[model samples]
Target: MEHIEPVISVKGLSFRYRMSETVILNDISFDIFPGELVGIVGASGSGKSTLCLCLKGLIPHAIHGEMNGDIWVLGQNTREVPTEKLAVDVGMVFQDPESQIIGLTVIEDLAFGPENLEHPPEEILNRMLPILDKVKLQGFLNRETYKMSGGQKQRLAIANALMMQPKVLILDEPTSELDPIGKEEVYSTILELKKNGVTVVLVDHAIEEMAEIADRILVIEEGKLKYDDTPKNHFQSPEKFLEKGWLRIPQIAEALHALKGKDLLSEKYVTPFEEEAISTLSAWLGRESNVQFTVD
Candidate 1:
């Protein structure tokens, strides 16, 4: 079998702000392969955002900080490469959509990155048109960005990032401030991106969303990496995460765990999706009492 190289690699990474004595990130390390959607979860002040910055080459370069260890994205050392150069390969969407939004209109915002890179007008249009449709903002091309809703702005932020044609994208709490509909809109966009083979690194407190979409999950605690495992494994033992105040397991997993404790569910059955959970439970119940249960 041939080995696949990771698109992003971090080794013994550590950092402390210039004037601060406290270490913001302890010796952290991980690898992200191409076309993977990795979710990062942690309590507030746990250095999740800091790690995103590092992946984007913002740490120790744009931010004043003392750092140790190395992070390589697409074979380029983050410390050695300028952020502008890194931006071409790794695009990042911040917690606040407004912070990254620079253009007055949707078209201008989507074109900003490529425009700065001096892409030809025709090439920029080719890139922008498809991304606008991909992000479901095709009709908002001439709309004033400031007048858009929260979800529209978030999707716009993602569309803007996509304009760079980056291979890897990192999002820091991209849906944190949106309403339920808005959150769903952003989540749909993320799933679409993953389906199209974009490597995504997402940091968010939306544990349910992570469970539903992430290929793998990383748990960060107090500037240290505590857990890196599949969502099924992490949520299988909800107590472990709940005990440490790290995450809330998806509701389906929570119910399944309780059923398993009562010896009503087999250890082999573990999932975060409601439809899967319902099917598993319905089959088990039917075998026990000839009951027929179906999802509506």
Candidate 2:
């Protein structure tokens, strides 16, 4: 089988809000391959949001900041590429949906990104329906944008980004403001995007949710790239995260850790899902039911 190349690459990346200010991203580097769902977790002010901005070519183009690094999304250097040109390949949905949305109706909002790219109206109409359905917004095309609930607006924001059919989607804290149902809708859309081979970068404090879906996890702290590993590997050694309190282990992982403290669990057992943990516990209980041990 042939190896797939990375779609996004960063090398020696460092960014500061101002020339004299403290660095937000300090010499961090990583790569994301196509069709990967990557999660970024960190405390507030740890540069998770700033890194998202850099991924989409907005740092030097739309926002003013001191940047020293190379960021290539879909093979174009972010520093040299125009934001408009990059937008064709990268779409970003922010934490606040209202800030990025401007159309009066859902259809209008979905049409904005495509229309600005000079796509004809008929072509846009042809593409809009399926895109709305992708986000589970099929019946909401004519609804007023402002009147939709928080989750709906967030999904619409994602739909607006998807309208352009970008190769990579960047979502910054996309589910932070949503309730459980709203978060479920948002996360389902994310999984669907991944299924369709669109690269996804999600930044959020929802570690449990990320552990459920992310192909890989990146933990940043104090303007540095701290841990970049699989979710299972990262959580197996929770001390790294617990030491600084920059990241949180999923509650399910905590329960499993507690189980491992006893002699029932294998010394090498590791998993992040509650269902898997339950299965393991059930099997252990069934086998141990016939055996009794005396305390030493």
Candidate 3:
């Protein structure tokens, strides 16, 4: 087997704001490989956003604070590299889409990053064409940026980041403020990015959505690294998380777990989606055909 290098690596990372005794992050360490979609979850104030800032070279560079340990992005130390340079390889989308927008129109917004990089107009147009389509905003080129729906604004923010052609994209609660339809729009774009091989680190409270798309889930609790495992494993014992208010289990997994507690399920099953739940339940029912069952 070939060894693949991690696109992002953090070693013994710890941090706290200057003049503050409270530690925002404590001895956190992890590696994210190429083309992986990893979800970071925890209760609010778990330092998830701070971690995102660290990954993007904002913590030690732009934000003033005491920092320990090292973070390497594409093998370059984030501490050593300038944030502007890091922005080329690492893109970030914040909780509010409007915060990242700077252009009056969609095209202007998309061109902002590359334009600053001094790319020619023709080259900028070339870059925007494909990304516009990727985010499903090709038809909204001339549209006013402020007039877009919540979902559209978020997609535009994503496309703007893609204009930089970053190798790693970190999204912090991108769907928190959106309607259901808006959330789905952002989710679809994220899945599309994964398919295209862009490594993503997402911080979100939508556990069910994360279960569906995340290759691995990293749970943080009170400035500590709690769990780093696949969705199935991380969510298998939802009680442990629910009891502490760390995360919400996917509905299917929660239901399956409840059934298992009553001995109705012969084995523990963690289902993140309806289709998988259907298949697993059908198989179990087939084996229990001889046993009579009553539905309350």
Candidate 4:
């Protein structure tokens, strides 16, 4: 079997609306490899959505903007490629699932992409049934999309994207609309996608959750790419990105920060699980038995 290069690559990418002199994205560059789950994060209006649009070929193609630099998906330059063609190489799931969903029913929506691509009916069905199961929507395939919960609707949007079988999958705040249970379901789904060797790019404000799933994390600030590193390193220096208010700080970091001034809180507990956080703090406090806890 032949090896494939990165599914998505962006270099010196910058964008701004025609009427505005201010740039919404500036000198952003990143690469997403096959089977890697990468997270993009920043504060509100930090150009997260604009960057996503650019990556999806919607910035210059569908939206009017002054765009600069090169974005390559599946080895094709996005500047010269139409979204319809890029759709085969890259799939984008927006924050609002309702905005992306158009089919009256779930199965119809899932089939829309494959149908447009002129995929044979048998082949489409071959791929469809397994994907529905992958997303845990097996029984809901024929259900009306409007009747589905926010999380289920989001899954439908993802199914629509997956129907394309693109090399790269981009999700913008896939869990922002979900309740706690919904968030869990979506995250589990994402993990399944990663296991299937799909390149994943996630744009979200939920830092801790992303950390749990992402192999690499990139922080954008005022339209500029700032920090690019593994989740472990990003959490080690959350303050650097946290200062800009665009990066998501890990939950344990937040808990530790909240318990500042106590020696027990200074120990590292990077995982997302609450049990790990408690256990680490307990051990740290136990080690300092000689030092009594004094309420200030």
Q: Model 2, 129-236: lDDT tens per residue?
A: 988877778889789988998888888888888888878999999887778776877788889889999999999777888898999999888889988999888877
Per-residue alpha-carbon lDDT of model 1 for 1-296, expressed as tens digits?
Answer: 98999999999999998899999899999999999999999888999999998999999799988899999999999999999889998999988898899999998888888988899989998888878887678788899999998778888888888888778999999887778776777788889889989999999888887888999999998899989999888887777876776577787888887877787776556578766777788777675433354422
Better of 1 and 2 by lDDT: 1
Q: Cα deviation in Å at residue 214, candidate 3? A: 1.0
**Model 1 regions lying over 4 Å from their true place:** 287-296
> What would you estimate as the lDDT of candidate 3?
0.87
Q: All predictions: root-mean-square deviation over Cα? A: 3.4, 3.2, 3.4, 4.5
Candidate 2 lowest-lDDT run of ten: 287-296
lDDT of 3 by residue, 1-296 (tens): 99999999999999998888999999999999999999999888889999999999998998989999999999999999999999988999977889899999998998889989999999999989988887778788889998998878888888888899888999999887677776777788899889989999999988888888999999998888899999878766777886886588888888888887787764345567666677677666774343343433
RMSD of 2: 3.2
| Model 4: residues with Cα > 4 Å off, grouped in runs | 1-5, 241-246, 257-261, 265-279, 285-296
By lDDT, highest first, what's the ranking? 3, 1, 2, 4
In candidate 2, stretches whose alpha carbon ends up further than 4 angstroms from where it belongs are: 1-3, 262-264, 287-296
Clashes found in each candidate (C-alpha, N, C closer than 3 A):
0, 0, 0, 2
Off by over 4 Å in 3: 284-296
Better of 3 and 4 by TM-score: 3
Q: Model 2: which residue pairs collide?
A: none
TM-score of each: 0.91, 0.91, 0.90, 0.85
Please, what are the lDDT tens digits per residue for candidate 4 over residues 95-127? 889999988988788888888878888898888
Q: Each candidate: what lDDT?
A: 0.86, 0.84, 0.87, 0.80
